[model samples]
Target: MVIVLKNQLRIVKKNIRQFIENITSLFSSKISDLLLAILLIPYLISKVGIENYGRYVFALSLTLFLVNIINYGFDLSAVRELAKNRHKPKMLKKLLNKVLSVKLYLTILMLVILFVVVFTIPLLRVEKTMYFFALFLIIGDLFSLRWFFMGIEKMKYIPIINVGSKLLYVFLVIIFIKQSEDYEIIILLEGIGLFIVNIFSFLYIVRKKRIRIKLISFYKVKCPVLK
Candidate 1:
């Protein structure tokens, strides 16, 4: 009975440790996101002038709508799937591949749609470059594997890479953005940071985590969408 109790206590301690780590990492990432908004957004508004800033925000809103269409609730569903299959290497790889493949297809379709809409709308046509630049945000999100890490309950890397990338973005903005004209590059700067960090994180997951991404057939990819 004493030995059994000791084993149970050990399990409890391990679970508690994991819970604390997850909470701490989540908190750190959220704080960094908040800081990015609080610290950089006002600076951007000031440097870019209200008119240009308003245009950027308007373009951003449009991009976000496409982002949602591409996302299609995979962020939540994939996390649940990953949690279930994390220990099963074959299943996990297949599932991950399906999700990635589907998301890639969706992104491409959205990009084309965005191109059409931006060109069709006379108002959006004026700052079409900004709209196209904002498309990179979708691409950046495409490569982000925060859902995978969260599924495995290893949240540490999310905050580290997130904070690093945001810091890089802030630094680049401060150095390059001198006047309202520079507002055009603001989204592009963010895209650069996201690409650098997310690509690194994706490679890290592949090499360090030993998870490989393979392309599957449309038939295999079709079921995930229905589910």
Candidate 2:
């Protein structure tokens, strides 16, 4: 019937509009990240000197190496599973609980490995403090609801959350970092920025999406491991 066709057309148009909005927001956020990085990197490099900058990079790189290991490729799986079941609120909550539980276990295991590597490696041992500071990055990343929002195909809030946190980070860095000794604050800022953005995003989801994150047992279903 014509009414059925009209309804379908309206739905299609609405979805298209939403898709465009999501893309625009995501793009803008990415641009902001790039611009912020471009502005900060030169100032940081010159302020800290080459040797200190290298050390900081080395520490962050080592930390991110663990990140790759900790993630263990759950990103795609989470997006697929969550996105497929986005319409069902109960299912979304259940999936989120399971994902968080599994990720927590994974984090514990990865952290054990991380500390082992940090203690054994000479480079990491020297930068032990920074290495430890960078570990919070993993926690920040894990708690980030980026996958959840991406699954639901809602991206408007991400830009706001990301930019706000980054702005604060920039402010802190500018105010506090003056010389090489202050380079430790850089990694901490990265971790803090991630933590803050995720906190904002998580709270937004809880309030606006009406999703509760409770500790649920994964015993009933076969839980998927990151490995």
The most accurate candidate by TM-score is 1
Candidate 1 C-alpha error for residue 124, in Å: 0.5
TM-scores of the candidates in the order shown: 0.93, 0.89
Q: Model 2, 3: alpha-carbon shift in Å?
A: 1.8
Superposed Cα deviation of residue 168, candidate 1 (Å): 1.4
Candidate 2 TM-score, C-alpha based: 0.89
| Tens digit per residue, CA lDDT, model 1, 116-192 | 99899999898888877887788987888887888888899889989988998899899999999987788888877
lDDT scores in order: 0.84, 0.79
Tell me how candidate 2 scores on lDDT: 0.79
lDDT: which candidate is best?
1
- Pairs that collide in candidate 2 are none
**Candidate 1 pairs with clashing backbones:** none
Model 2 per-residue lDDT tens digits across residues 1-227: 99999999999999999999999989999999999989988989988888888888887887777777656656688778888888888888887777777777667777888889889998778878877888778788777776677788877877887888789788878887898898876888888878887877777777886777776455632356422
User: Which ten contiguous residues of candidate 2 have the minimum total lDDT?
Assistant: 218-227
Question: Could you give me the TM-score of model 1 versus the true structure?
Answer: 0.93
